[model samples]
Target: MNITISTFMKIAVTVIVISALLFSVGYQMVVDESNHYDSELDRYKNESLGR
Candidate 1:
């Protein structure tokens, strides 16, 4: 079996693109969850202080 340079480059590019996309999505999700937790913690603290 013989693989051409063009074919190899195409595969590499595809893998890289997919990896970048997944990383971006995962990073965004983590940021969103962190933000949510931060807000919740702030709310809890405010409630506690009001008592």
Candidate 2:
């Protein structure tokens, strides 16, 4: 395969796209986990309201 400027650009673009996708997925997972923890904390707080 010939390594031209276009090839280099394509490779760079692919790497960037994959990196962005991974970051987005990881960020969303973190958000979901944080939300779950928050909900649990809220439930615990409500349960102890009368204490």
Candidate 3:
């Protein structure tokens, strides 16, 4: 079993790309959900809306 430098580099790059993509997607989802919750809370607290 012989692994060349090219093959190792390709595998490493692929893993890094996939990891970055997954992290970005997950981070975005969390941020979006937090923003939505914050907006909803703000709307609920608005006293002018009681008019």
Per-residue lDDT tens digits for candidate 1, residues 1-51, read 256888998999999999999999999999999999999999999999994
CA lDDT of each candidate? 0.95, 0.94, 0.91
Tens digits of per-residue lDDT, candidate 2, 1-51, equal 467988999999999999999999999999999999999999999889953
RMSD of 3: 2.8
The C-alpha stretches of model 2 lying farther than 4 A from their native spots are 1-3
lDDT of 3: 0.91
Error of 2 at 22 (Å): 0.3
Better of 2 and 3 by TM-score: 2
RMSD values, in order shown: 2.3, 2.6, 2.8
Output the worst ten-in-a-row residue range by lDDT, candidate 3: 42-51
Best by TM-score: 1
